[model samples]
Target: MEVFSEYLIFSARYDVSMVTELDDSKPEIKAVTLDLWETLLLERDGANEQRNLIRCRNLARALSKFGVKISVDRLISVLKAMTPWLLTVWEKNREVTHLDQIRFIIKAATDGSVSLREEWLDELSSAYVSAIYELPPYLNPDAPQLLRWLKDHGKKIGLICNVGRTPGFILRRFLKDEGIGNFFDVMIFSDEAGIRKPHPEIFRMAARRLGVKPSEIIHVGDNLRSDVWGAKNAGFKAIHFSTRKGRDTIAESDPNSLISISRKLGGLKEEEIIPDRTITSLAMAIEGIEELER
Candidate 1:
């Protein structure tokens, strides 16, 4: 096993070939923990772009009602500058609430010279949430099947998601709308939990809520550092759902985002982030879990 500051990666050899059946006799895992974005849900093509435009427009409109008068371009730029700070908070495994985000933007818009009323902040947050609601991301096609399979097989399922800008309350509503909310026995969102992944606390909390030991829970997620390293550190088995086929593609598409997030969060090497198993799609999760037990 390759050990990093916060986690250990077990080196194992197994056939990566697809398995078509689950060995009903080998049901050792008591629970399963899943990541939210990219694992069970994916934004529709160009959905992110559309959401950003809507967010900017709504935010600008909200500020206008407060007589703040910030242009959409300026709002976007202020938000972009706040990304690093947002990352910094996340790196600490801490969550920045939606209200706090709006406060920061308002501060930036006014060059640190203005303070908005509490009612105004609430208005901005609601507007932002409304925009997000208008363009909710759809779930991956295979997600419902996988989630149902696990639940029907008597495994306690939980969701561990990192949130920024959007709160956990909103996400729960989205899950219900998509018809998978009932599958999760427990849902832990960073904003609600006050800690984000790569943090052992978050993983441990999920295990606690599910009434299972960390060793008896398998965490499946797409991000190497956040999901794999975090779960491993908490003594849980992990499966990496490489949605883009491989790490190379992920790095190429968003070179700085994940790497920088990992670095700021501390204690993960590329090698240490390796998972016990890798699945290219969510449909493979069932077999992957069974294989791990074997």
Candidate 2:
């Protein structure tokens, strides 16, 4: 009876140890979230400038028709003035609405000296949102294949993008027009989420919508603060996409813009925060994620 009792105790201890080991094992990766601007879509040097120009021209015409008689240069000046504010809000990881942006342009152009009638406000907002079609950003050469590969491997895909002059509706259309809209299982924009990346909550939101835990997801992007630091702080595995040359283009053509300053990895200490993997080529994305998995 004593020998039997000792054998029972050993079996119970072994079973508990096995269960604890399984519990501590890393969860399987169930989803991938990517940054849209630099990670998936590559913008040319002057696309943003051109898009704003188009908006100013369109708004000037609209204002003239509405008897407001605003000049394009006036509109340009207002936009330039707002750049600092935009950077300030973004640095705080806060977002402004598209309507508020349009209202600012009008408020600045009029110097609060003139007020447009109710109907004109709606007309002006449309002019602001529709500029992306006039001058569009191009897709990253390898983004489509990378997205497809993720889908084929049974990974849920998502996009967490920060919208600037161009808004989310237009960006969604651009994605569909570029033939990659159907690939994503989820899409989160700062304008819509009311919270931007590096906030941790936004990352958690994506994970919840993608039906996975944060630990079971990997995020890929070009920006260090917004993408890498954001994901890691939220308990996600991150892959830094550093290809600025060749086919794997990441971020805008110009990296010195003020907006880039707060988001990208310039003059920042890289010793404290680090990505689980870094891939220079989008083709090596699979390898990067696989390495993180192991």
Candidate 3:
């Protein structure tokens, strides 16, 4: 959690034939690297976001058709009430569960904000508005600043996303929506690769496409094995994005315990602690890399 500056020596030795490419004309993309999900597109960790709020709103709207006539303001109140329970659900499954049923139950629960029917309401609408809005480190919003900064230093950027079930389609949609699709030279997704991180092949695939030896590229991500060790072992510069949440409590605890907990949770690793560079915010990441070069 403590972002420390440590010098590291990286190994670079890649066998080329083992790497296959779909196209050789993509400028050997100067930097073929990335770890998607939390690294680039950050959805709200808890329930407080535009999409789920709207999801609740849409559910309420649909229930109106069923003669339940719930006002959006009242639905907003319901969403506010649901926010506390939202964390419980996230901590439980890391994904929203039974959304329609939950909202309908919320409308009906005496403990819920609006007490309507207790037993059963008709089926809620199938309008899932989960991916409505996206947060920052967006490809477009600050691109002129970020791209100008990254471009000035002659670093090419690409994505190396490790998705569990979400495919490249979702990733592309998010990027395209943000209007920053032009930034990445290549986009790699776990679903597309049929292999997940801690596996060397995926990294190899990225390096191959970039036409640069892995050693020349630096991979930035939130995960340790997928982003750090995987790239480190594959001979690329590995940088870890240690978040404040992971470190805030540790700021008070003994550093050893912090390191231990981080390791256990896959956030901290022995080699990871000593990244060639460490960054807390992507906005500052390019600056950090410049500082490292200095």
Candidate 4:
């Protein structure tokens, strides 16, 4: 079966087609685990630049109260230099929490000479979280409908997302603000779990929370490494949501990124980590689920 939309076309040309055929007769998909960023939500255009500015300004403000004054330019430079360290942690399937990030920034900026009170750290983290409001991530046009469809069909739903910059707590609040929070039966964040995706443990954690075996759930996401590779390795059917708007572009552009590293670890073959199905939009997730139900 083919599913198409104005923004996407679904096909079964690769190993995904074979996986679909194999699972066609025994559809036990009782739940769906979704990736948060890019899968269900998108950062607005120019939001990244604006958010970075807000972060620098807020960090500066937070530091001022603690008798540490720094220019936003210096703060930005320190934060930019931390990206590789952050990526290194993620590559090891661990997440650096927002608190840890704040601590690192403070240490770097102060040259390890100053110690902040707990209250000050909280103030800084709050400021960082609030910056998201400048350009909040909005749901994909199809996310609400798809989520509702899954819930109405009696399928359990969960979110297994890798947190970056914005922590899982804030993302949960964002979900509630967008009016889709109640749809998930379980929500797991990499920072909170201490294990990022492409790691089987995180997927298994979601499965345990949902009271289903990994094989009984279908994991959907826009990342091939963390989403597809992780879920498949965990024994869950997987869907590669190949939306054009998300992190896929970054992976496509950089040959040495985490996703690239993951692809290499999967034997440098696309088919080795190919998802059970591929859809271009959230709107097509329902179709992929339906095909699996067949």
Which candidate has the highest lDDT of all?
A: 4
Backbone clash numbers for all candidates listed: 0, 1, 2, 0
**lDDT of the structure predicted as candidate 2:** 0.81
Candidate 2 on 1-294: residue-level lDDT in tens? 999999799887788678778987877999999998767887666666677889999989888887787899999889888877777687778888777777788888999976656788778877888887777777888988899889998999989987887668778888999999999999998888988778898999999999899999999987777889999999899998876542222124445444444455434676766888888867788899887776
Question: All models: lDDT?
Answer: 0.80, 0.81, 0.55, 0.82
Structural similarity to truth (TM-score) of each candidate: 0.84, 0.86, 0.52, 0.85
| Segments in model 4 whose C-alpha atoms lie over 4 Å from true places | 1-27, 250-268
What's model 2's lDDT at 33? 96
Q: Lowest summed lDDT over 10 consecutive residues: which window, candidate 2?
A: 245-254
Ranking by lDDT: 4, 2, 1, 3
- Which of candidates 1 and 3 is the stronger one according to lDDT? 1
Q: Which stretches of candidate 2 lie over 4 Å from their true place?
A: 1-24, 245-258, 262-268
Relative to the true structure, candidate 2 has a C-alpha RMSD (angstroms) of 3.7
Give the alpha carbon lDDT tens digit for every residue of 207-293 in model 1: 999999998999999888888988999999999888664334434455454333443335546775779899988999999998887
* Stretches > 4 Å off in candidate 3: 1-32, 47-144, 246-273, 291-294
Residue lDDT tens for model 3, 11-71: 1343343344423322222463656655665533332244545666766666666566656
After the best TM-score superposition of candidate 3, give how far the Cα of residue 178 lies from its true spot, in angstroms. 0.2
Task: Look at candidate 3 and give me any clashing residue pairs.
Answer: 28-210, 34-160
Give RMSD (Å) of candidate 3 vs. truth.
Answer: 13.0
lDDT of 3 at 196: 55
Error of 2 at 208 (Å): 1.1
